[model samples]
Target: MLLAVVLASVVFSAHAQSVPKPKEFYFDEDKTTARPIVVVEGEGEAQVQALVRERDRGRRQLEATAQLAHIAFSDGRTDLGGQLYQQALAQTDAKGTLGRAVRWNYAWDLFRAGQVEPALTRWVEVASAYGSPSWAPPTLALALWRLDRKQEAVAWFGAAVRTEPAVWIDARNFASQLPDWKQEDRDTLAEVLGAWQANPPTWP
Candidate 1:
């Protein structure tokens, strides 16, 4: 009888492990893809460990795959992260908030690794997924600028400037405007803004 109780307790503990509920965990308040890359240090070790266990067992369901993919990136396992991100995206609605969040984080991971062109593609997909979300133009502008696509960059900048010209024109506002971006990203966007001011895009 005592043995049966111990076995049942073990089974209960196994079944009681918390299932991950992944919403748009990587998006900004603006519902745009965020820039901050995931790091193992950002989450609880317990949660990370659980996600890894799920990943190894191939038991990662749709949203759980997203969480494990994020953890994989945080663990510096880039290839594994990419694979898992692909798997999650395949299983989820690619146009949904959760899907965008996964793609955004994947793009960020690529961008951080200096794969800017691929990152740009993913960002463009996300930017166009909605009615050109307010948060995208600035980041897109800077990325295009970085790639020497000056005209396109300026056009993207124009969208942002139109929305918040007062904010975009001043360098002081950039740090606050892009609170989620790294200092380097903010600086590059400032450069793009400066060039756009020198010769604004032509339009109606």
Candidate 2:
């Protein structure tokens, strides 16, 4: 009788252990993908770990992928983030606004990861697709500068100041940090900044 009771208890414990726990999910307000809710944990690292599991399960695949990519980037896993971003891009519409935002984010991630060539390609695509996203000017300028395209970098800085005057200060600050930028490029940026300051836009 004692042996049977012990055996029964062991079996019950094993059965319980075999059953997966129900995961609690919540909506991720920042993402645009369908079924954006994911499993949550207490906070910070624990939450991120839960997200990693959710990402692997293919639940809300695109949103989970993008979220994981962001978390990876924040955690200093830029290579993983870039790879995940590429996967997310494959799931997103190339012509849509979400696609543009994802591409821009991926480009920035690549740049931060020291993958300049790939970053340059993505930045060029962003610049060509939409005139100038707020981040495009400085980011594209940096990419161009890294590629030894000084003239193009100057042109983009001028475009930033002329088209998106609100980001002129950002562009100026970034341009000032480029070690390879020529005097001509600096002068061009200065000229555009002067023009923008002299004739500030009335509307935001």
Candidate 3:
């Protein structure tokens, strides 16, 4: 998830196929699952510099810019972050795995910034991608909940526990397990978990 973002980030060479593996930059090495990479708050100094160097040289240009954008977003620099994300995405393959990861970061940032509709819209693409993360159902549920789509929200929560059988059974587990999720998101998921527990989905 360590990509760069600059307005000049799109100038790619014909030999630009050396796409970096982004997971290396998604979080600190100790993280079990990915969370927002907050550069301004004591993490990822080395990786961020690496991205800047790569961006300067136009290597994996699009992805470097996107990753930088994520850093900016994490620091609450929303407008700059969004601009960088869009610029990098202009050359992105939305159907590709790399692009999905970028979309996930951007969508979550949008969600955090209270742009639910667009966030959910981007998530629709990510959800349909091959190898979508198991953590997705709760995210979908919370987004639907925020939009007042309660039935859909609860059903998605049910879908989550049906797969893991226990992982998302209690919202309280969410804090430790999903360390990257903001508290509001966890609370929203808790609401979904409660609703699902009350009336689990029944197949028609």
Off by over 4 Å in 1: 1-45, 53-61
Poorly placed runs, candidate 3 (over 4 Å):
1-51
Ranking by lDDT: 3, 1, 2
How much is the lDDT of residue 138 in candidate 2?
46
Supply the global lDDT for candidate 3: 0.69
Model 3, span 105-172: residue lDDT tens:
78888988888877877776766554435656777788888977788787767667766666779777
Total backbone clashes of candidate 2, pairs 3 or more residues apart or in separate chains: 0
Instruction: Quote each prediction's TM-score.
Output: 0.72, 0.55, 0.72
How much is 85 displaced in model 3, in angstroms? Answer: 0.9
Candidate 2's residue-wise lDDT over 45-117, tens digit each?
7777777777778556666677778668868988788788889889877556667667766666666666766
Tell me model 2's lDDT, rounded to 2 decimals: 0.57
Which wins on TM-score, candidate 2 or candidate 3?
3
| Models sorted by TM-score, best on top | 1, 3, 2
- Angstrom error at residue 85, model 2: 2.0
Error of 2 at 63 (Å): 2.3
